[model samples]
Target chain A: MAEYKGVMTYCEIAEGSLPSISREVAGFGRKLADDLGEELCAVLVGSDVGNLAQDAIGLGADTVYVVDDPLLKEYQTDAYLSVMEKVVRKMMPRILILGQTSVGRDLAPMLAFRLDTTATLDCVGLAIDPGTKLLLQTKPVFGGNAQATFTSDFCPQIVTVRDKLMPPPEPDASKQGEVITLDAGLDPAAIRASLLKRVTENEGGVRLEDASIIVSGGRGIGSAEGFDQLQELAALLKGAVGASRPACDNRWLAPNRQVGITGKIVNPDLYIAIALSGSIQHLSGCAQSKSIIAINKDPEAPIFNYADFGVVGDWKKVLPAFRDKLKELLPG
Target chain B: MRIIVCIKQVPDPQASSSGTKVDPEAMRVIVPQGTPPVMSPYDENALEAAIRIKDAHGARVTVISAGRNLAKPVLRKSLASGADELVLLEDAAFEKLDSYATAHLLVAAIREIGEYDLILCGRQAADTDAGQVGSGIAEILKIPCITAASKVELSDGKVLVERVVSDGFEVIEAPMPALVTASSEIGDLRYPKLKDLQAAQKMPITVRGAQALGIDAAGLKRVNLVRLAEPPRRKTECRIIGGETPEEAGANLALKVKEAKLL
Candidate 1:
């Protein structure tokens, strides 16, 4: 067995900028590295994301490895995997961490299989076992009904942490780190997959991760028209409009707007859930929010158990008046 | 064309949490009361994807599952749902195989089946939600793997897939013998007619074991669940608004939200 060394985090870039998950994972990786008495590193793989190394150092990484190549501009599975495999083999990190995004979900498994290692994805909690020095990865299973902790007796324990579970550490601008640029050594011919084009869909006004306030609707929303009301309220508050799985499955809202275990996990300042019964799956996603408000017609809805404020009534009648009251209270 | 679709049966996810319990001693979940084991919802989507492909290209669809004491009714339901054949990879030792071992076992079964053009699986099993086996199978087979595919088609001898991305969807082209993990967006599974259900009940299903597939099940586990417990419960006491009508509750809730500074 190869002797394990340090903790490394794979940084993700979106829309030509580093997503908050990169920093969040860095903070998380920093803690794990400190506990293990090893170095913390970050791998930035993109065409021109080299400048991201400084920010990564500020966030937590002591060493930033860059794999800059034009062929790596857009995320293609084979291309990214090739670079990651090379990096992991060279660094021999004891632990590897990634964001539980679409790309990470696809990449982590393939890499783990290739490395002859094991990975736990969409993990909510991570800890170190002082006894054996293994990563204790906790994630919701059976749709958040129960939690299971897994440990891998292998080098490079790979884990993909759910977004927003931990806040990124404060960055000191004066902090310095070593930024090393390495050749991706990627040959386009060796890659079996190629990106023909990229498409960007127009999501609702605010991105789920960046929203401070969110208004979410569920099965009780009735139809696409019902979501329109929720959208109006969200727009007024300058927040995002999210939905439970049923809302998206019914095609009343876009799949990306769904907020739950199967959807985007959010931790906003305040989450206003309307007409949602608060299934364990949906609650698991937003459980980290600072405060939650539930509005449903059923007085016995499960959402009430986790909500700070509850209202029992028809959303159709309640939403309009609530929107109007909000318009009155915060006149812009 | 020959297509293989893998499916797993799990407890219905929609079952109320009140009946769900965790057995820390066994480090496993006791299925919620009154919830029968059913085909995983996402696997239904995968089966639907296979049926659609078969319908389009005049192909044969074979559904395979690796588990312990595989239920007959559940596998029969899949057959009624348009699968041309059913194969059960079972063993008492196979009961607790992780995703890695599961993929290896499935790969061996596929190899024994001899010929296949495409393989499909659910994006993730609802039980573990590891979402790794599909890609793992693809890696061992040295085939291109696409995940979260909402749409898949056999186009000019290549697999054309529309996979979901964070922002939107992307269409990818891969050669034959590729693997795809179907997502819920693939559309609803087709309901089998009464006649088909009756016929499926009489059809012979093939059963195989780890010895038959030449895999040592005990040696393949790369990860294991160390402990299991119910997630910590939220400790918020919901303050229900007192109101005579929906309008009254709405107004008072707005005031309360304002007081909470959550508006």
Candidate 2:
């Protein structure tokens, strides 16, 4: 444990740039390393990703390790895991942080297992205990009805944090750091999984994370066509459309459009829930919205408890009038 | 093809919050009286994935579940849905085993069950929601693992999986004998026919304990659960818009939105 003396953030690159989650974990990793009076580092693994070392330094990592390889162009489990295992074995950081995305969720647990350690995934909060120097991982459980904190008694404590949960990294452009390049040691035979292709099928619209207002529906939306109605309203307001887990499970909405404990978290200026009963699972994602409005026939729906405004009616009847009024009131 | 689907029985997530309550002091949920446990929803999706593969190709589907006290009737749904065999890994010490221990036990059971080509599991449990065991089991078995798969297609002794990413889905390919964690995107489990359900109830189940698997479950926990508590409450009094009709309510709701300067 004494040999593992620093914090390491596993940074991810998307479309030739550092994603928001990479910056966030790096920022939070700095605080953890500082608290332990240890160094902070970042591991950048991807093709042509070494150029971001300065950005990593600016983001608070004292040292940046670059593993540049063409084979690492896109994420493949076998290749990424081998690279991560090599880096961790070399750096031996006391704490490892990763973003809770498709990659991290797949990699962290396997990496931890390979190293004979444990990892806490999808953490909403992380803190270093002052007295015992333990990294406490706080996460939601039981469909977000309950919360639990966990601590690992192992080296290189790994945790995958839910994206956007932490404040963004404030880069100091003037900051400088050490950069080291490592070779993954070519062995194509070692990689088992191959990426066939990545398909992007998201409907053209304002991304929910970037939208200021979101029009969301639920089981009551009925069909894909019903979601189209919500999408029209979302377009009218220059917002995005989302749905509860039921709608996503029913395939009425793309799985990515699902907002709940198992889906993406969004915090917009306003969230309009149409015929969706706000279960704790669903609220876990959008409860942080500035204002929530619920339109449901069930006056006793749990959504009303957390909503700022309620309209007890069928959305088919209520939505048109509301959309029509908004069309008349607002200038595009 | 030999596909093994891992499932777990949990307090029905569809049940209202009133059906279950968290016991902060004891660090567990108090199951409501008379509410029968259901297969974790994602696990049902996993079983559905297995059945679909079996439907498209000639394969045998075996369902394996590990827990302290698993309900036979709830697990029988897997058989009714199309599983040919049911294997239950049960023991007193299996109740609170960590993800690694759970995976280790499953791996042992997989080993004992002999030949297998592909393994499937839910993305995460509805109760604990850790989502680690499937990946851990894959790691221990040294096989490629694809997590959060929406569609899995088999061809030429390999599997092409469409997995959900942040913005969309990506296609990944791995050799057979790999593991996949299915998500809701795979779609809901099929409702078994009444005749099938009746036949499943009469099927024999193979039950194994920790001693049979040669694992000391009590010694496998590596992480400490510090405490459990209700998540911070988010509350506000909802102001209901009044109107003579539903259409009027909609018009009035829009006015409120405008008043709030939200649009």
Best by TM-score: 2
RMSD to true structure for each model, in Å: 1.5, 1.3
Task: Give lDDT tens digits, candidate 1, residues B121-237.
Answer: 999988888889998998888888888887898888988888877677788878878899998888879999999989999999999988888899769998978889999988999
Q: Each model's TM-score, in the order given?
A: 0.97, 0.98
TM-score of 2: 0.98
Model 2: how far is B11 from its true place, Å? 0.7
lDDT of model 1 at position A326: 77
lDDT of 2: 0.90
Q: Give the runs in model 2 whose Cα sits over 4 Å from its true position.
A: B16-19
| Model-by-model DockQ, in order | 0.72, 0.80
Query: For model 2, which pairs clash?
Result: none
User: For residues A246-282, what per-residue lDDT tens digits would candidate 1 score against the true structure?
Assistant: 8887889877787888788999998999999999889
- Interface RMSD values for the candidates, listed in order? 1.5, 1.1
